[model samples]
Target chain A: MRALFAFIAGGLFGSGLFISGMTDTAKVQGWLDVFGAWDPTLAFVMGGAMIPMAIAWIIRARRDTPVLGGTFPPPAPREIDRKLIIGSVLFGAGWGLAGLCPGPSLASLSYGGIGHWVFFVAMLGGMLVAPRLSIRLDRTVPAE
Target chain B: MVMDWVWGLVGGLLIGLGGAVYLLANGRIMGASGIIGGLVDGTGRRDAVERVAFLAGVFLLPVLLYPLYTSIDTHITGNWGVLIAAGLLVGIGTRIANGCTSGHGVCGMSRLAPRGFIATVAYILAGGLGVVLFRHVLGVI
Candidate 1:
């Protein structure tokens, strides 16, 4: 039952990504191109996505358990640590380089681009090594 | 415009609504990275079914729905070197940060999480710099 809801939600999310032009790598790159020919379409997408999310947060303030009988998780930590900063930096670099982020990467699999498969596999490999690499990063740059 | 902003907005609303449902139903944030991350790293073994179900829907629906609408192109670069390098960076970065654009950018920022704001800023800035470095300077991307 819970999985069913999750499945439906995922379907909605992926469909949204597809319609929003997020799965289009070129559009993503255009949005990132602050200095060049900037496309403002992503701003609308970001704004559109945030509206319902903000409403959800507002609605949550009045409730305890969700409509589905689950406990609402606590807020994320407030600390702005090195891990968050550095990790975001690296992620952004990759996002700029490939114009692919996690959601769109997964969403683009059906696009049948060899680059997508290669990026997906490579992403998994990177995820596999992340624990060790992050430990090393912490030693060099420190973690929260 | 290459594409319409109306579609972007409509799509975003669906994405947000999906996330809202996930939060309201599962009491979990709808982040692609965290969901997939926990599954991949074995930390989310208990919830493996949920994660996989979510992924299955995200991945498989497009196969059926995409052709129904229209055949879309990813327009991703053919440079394998850049693709590999970027994939690794994204994987490692999102893992370490524990969020991505969907996770931190949408869910966090919408709720006014400071970490989300910072992460979003950092990534956007870094992404722009990367464009400058790769496209303008080195001509790699």
Candidate 2:
């Protein structure tokens, strides 16, 4: 039952990504192109997405457990650490360069061509290797 | 212009609805990177079945809907080198940072989490700077 809801949710999210042009790399790049022909469509998308999610968060605050009986996700991590900043910077660079993030990238798999495939494969490789790399980095530098 | 905003708003609402469903039904946040990231990193093994089910829905439903709509355009870049490089960066970055646009930007902000706001700001600023460097200064597209 929970899995079914997850599937439905994923489908809804994918459809939304496709409908809103979020799956389009050009559209995403355009939004990032502050100096070029800027497109504000994504801003509207973000605004639209936040509305119901905000409500959901509010509803969640009042409940001890979700409708399916599992404990809700813990509070968001509050640390503003080096890993957060550096990783985000790198992620932003990649997003700007390719105009593809995980959500849209996954949703685009159906029709995405060779470029998408390369990106997805490489992204997976990076994901696979990141933990080890972080572990090494942590050992060398030590967290402050 | 008007149509763009309308479509964006509608689509965003749908995305939010998906997040809401996941939160309500599974007691989890609908963060794509974290969901998939955990599977790859082995931290999400306990919830593997649910994650796979969600991914199947994300991947397969779009294929099913493609024929009916036939209008969605994904302008992914053709440069293999750039694609691979960008992919690597995204994978590493999102993993190290622990979220992405959907995770931190939409879900996190909606819940008024400080980390979400910080991550969002960091990525947006960095993304904008990346655009300036790649598209403008470097001309690397």
Candidate 3:
């Protein structure tokens, strides 16, 4: 049952990405191109996303248990440390350069865009490699 | 313009609803980065059914929608090396930060998690600087 809901939800998310045309890497890359004719599409997309998110958040906050079952687990707490800074910096650089983050990249793979395949492979590899590095370094940070 | 807004809203709702549903049902937050991260550490089976379904949806959505909207265009200029390097960096970032923009920006923020707040602010600042670095400083644009 939970899996089914998640599937439906994921489908909704992917459809949204597809409908917003975010699967098109050029459009995403355009947002990063601030000087050579700026594309405000990404901003608009962000704006569009915030609306429903805000509403859903409000609803979730007011309730103790969700309509489905358990109580909200709430995210774990942590301080902003060196790992946070470096990781975020890396994320920003990658996003600005590639114009596709993990979620959208995964979403876009359906388009069969070669770029997505490259992005997905690299993303999976990163997911694998980052953990081994963490284990090797004896770091205990949760993979965000 | 209308289509764009509609799609964006739908996508947001889906994520929010999915997240809410996931949290309500399993007492777990719907964070892709974390789930993906956990999948690496052998916790994959803990939520095996849901995780695989969520991931599959991520890949299947666009394929279903392509026929309805024909204006899609995906192009890239940079070489594969750069893209791979970027992915590596992002992987490291998510691990260190303990959340991605989605986890912090949506799930965390929704729960008013302080860490999420700080992480998100940092994310925005870094994102801004990265754009400047790539477009202006490096002249990639």
Listed for every candidate in order, the interface RMSD values in angstroms are 1.0, 0.9, 2.7
For A1-32, candidate 3 gives per-residue lDDT tens digits of 77777787677666666666666656666666
Every model's DockQ: 0.83, 0.84, 0.51
Ranked by TM-score, the better of candidates 2 and 3 is: 2
lDDT (tens digit, per residue) of candidate 2 on B21-129:
9998889999998988899889999989999888878888778878987465677767888999999999999998889999999999999888888888998888889
As for candidate 3, its clashing pairs are: A87-B93, A144-B98, A144-B99
**Best of the two (1, 3) by TM-score:** 1
- The local distance difference test score of each candidate is 0.88, 0.88, 0.67
lDDT tens per residue, model 1, A12-82? 89988888989888888888888788988888888999999999999988898987786898877998878
lDDT for B73 (candidate 3) = 64
Clashing pairs in 1: none
| Predicted candidate 1 versus true structure: per-residue lDDT over B52-133, tens digit per residue | 9888888976777787765577788999999999999999999999899999999999999999999999999999899888
Best by TM-score: 2
